[model samples]
Target: MIEATNTDLNSPKTESQSGLASLDPRSKILLACGFILTLSLLPPGEFLIYGLLLIVLYISASLSDCSPVYLVRRSVIALPFAFAAVTLLFTIPGESLLTLPILGIDISVEGAIRFASIVTRSWISVQAAILLIILTKVADLMWGLQGLHTPAILVSVAGFTYRYLDVLRSEASRLRTARQARSATLSAGRGGGTLLWRARVTGWMVGSLMIRSMERSERIYNAMLARGYTGEVKTLTRFELRSRDYWSMLVAALTAVIIILVAHFL
Candidate 1:
């Protein structure tokens, strides 16, 4: 029954940290989602619209007092999917720009535009998500989702995943440290000479780690039950929407709609 601390207590101040952190979590979530969904519908290759959106996003990041470099780096996590989207370069029909010799693949100009659009949209969407996370506390976010009538199971899963992810990581680190300590390369001749034997040992280590994880989970669950833990999560954050929340929501909705319209026009 561990709870999660989403924000860094020791992290230095950012520009938007104060402003974005003060807004209602529900408002932020809705606005971010709205922006992402609307932006997704935007026509590809509309650089003007994407530029406007990027400006808005960069401003939001700045207000949140978050580092622009950090946000850009974090958003790049979605870029790997660009490789998958690039396959459209071949499967899609368009004027051929060039062809590879060995694979005989024809690259199309239309496909190139579409691929750029895909990558741009993904980068923007990921940045939006990262901004939301940077400004919202994990517990407050879960509470907001519950208020929004999100599926209870999904909320519960998110809560537990956030809570236990660090625990699992710590356990894995300890296991790795112990293994390395016990199997020093100084005696590599006897126990770690053969590659096959080394692989078997690695497999055994993984099995042992899984067993430990299961035992730890069972123990934690039993302990929670003994303490009268139910399946319900209670939080102290209150969802009181003031004039600011409504105003922000209105501005965000209008901005999204306008952007969507502009995208369509472009």
Candidate 2:
């Protein structure tokens, strides 16, 4: 029953305080991106390789102080959608669970296997993404994207969007509380409103939030200007890959290469 709006991006859980914080952001980014790319590009039928990758991710998440429960909970949210798409595979005509006469559709064993493979791959991929967010700060993610040659405008947009989302959310929460307080005496059944009235209220809320955000942006710009702001953001700490970083990268690369070779041979 936890509302999504109550999720705080800035609050670091106990898992965030693990060894991951000690590693350079660059290393975390490289490892995460490399693993994700390999998983996505590799054949989903390579169960061995997928299993190894999942283990690696679990270890990394553990070292980072991320709770396995939290990771699993967040990752499982996508399972329903994946399940829906794969469910159709069981209904296709072939050697499936059962043959149906109503719709000349045949379900095959291959389809069921493929469906299972897709589900496993989807689960692993989602977990990888969640781990990435857990290990790397949002600012570091933006910086990493920049380093990877992402467009400046796109990076700027992402940065601004992340910053403003919290502001807007806070405003919305405050408004909701105020509304609840004012309507405390109203019966729940009578609280329903006309579509037009609801639309008008939503529009007003959006307009007010927009104005507040703009004003806040102006103030931020002025503060930056006073501090001799430049177009480039400079980081206080320079990222240097240590021996462990190279070792980690080497291990991941070797695993990927082995998987590719096995897939080709088998």
Candidate 3:
């Protein structure tokens, strides 16, 4: 969803393109995918390799001209999802480190390592994604996906989602505002009511929102059909891979493989 951010694909002459930005979006997308796959396939507890991949991620962020603050802020978005790995700390069987006081659950050393690996990979993947989005504009990225022969339906869905996301956000805001006008006068405690009441209200709100969204979507689809929208979405230009793309891919794939080999052997 980096498309939600402000990034210009078209710029006048004299704009500097260095490092990651110098590469075509399709090349970069494939390179990033390869790098992530390499990282994911590394043996568990290969901390040395993981550390090396982390360095590569930092280098990528720097090459994209990403501010450290912005990178950290964006990276936090994936942390909540990583918390699912925390369950592994208790689920995996191994030597126990500690037992829960009441339930008597054990935390195993192997499980801790596994959990850490999961979280580390998740963080690395998010950082790499953010770097790619920062360096490449959404339009180019979408075009790159099309060039890569990604499913046309998937591409169209992504395009439409990004296009109408802001409209959905606006609708949500209006819904919340309408609710707040009445909620402000109520004595409901945390988040507007008792837990059970809150659940009921939430369900009601969600149902209303769904109905409104469906109606709006139906109208939009009809309007588009009236305007003669075909099933295919077309872009102005078809991007071609260059010699630089081959070199970049070779370098990225080679570097990742070398790191994995070294991490495995040493």
TM for every model, in the order presented, reads 0.81, 0.79, 0.80
The number of the candidate with the highest TM-score is 1
User: In what order do the candidates fall by TM-score, top score first?
Assistant: 1, 3, 2
| Pairs of residues clashing in candidate 2 | 15-65, 15-66, 92-106, 92-107, 93-106, 93-107, 94-106, 94-107, 95-108, 96-107
TM-score (C-alpha, index-matched) for candidate 2: 0.79
lDDT of 3 by residue, 1-266 (tens): 22433433332221237777777879989877887898888878887678778787787666656654565667787877877788998999999988889999999999989988888887887777777777777767888888789998998889888777778766766766677666644454446667798678768888888899899989989998898888777767566777888888888888887877877787
lDDT of each: 0.79, 0.72, 0.76
Give lDDT tens digits, candidate 1, residues 38-123.
77889888977887888888887777677667778667668767889989888879899899889999999898889888898889
Reference-based lDDT, residue 253, model 1: 84
Local error of candidate 3 at 256, Å? 1.9
- The list of candidate 2 runs beyond 4 A from truth reads 1-7, 10-22, 90-93, 99-107, 181-191
lDDT tens per residue, model 2, 1-266: 12447455764544354666556666777776777777777764677778887887788778777766677878766767885766557654556565658986666776776677778878888887787777777787788777768898798778878977877787777876665556433455444467686677668777887888889889988987899877656655456667877777788789877777776677
Candidate 3 shows a clash count of 0
Residue 206 of model 1 has an lDDT of: 84
In candidate 3, stretches whose alpha carbon ends up further than 4 angstroms from where it belongs are: 1-16, 91-106, 184-200, 218-228
Q: What's the count of clashing pairs in each model shown? A: 8, 10, 0
TM-score of 3: 0.80
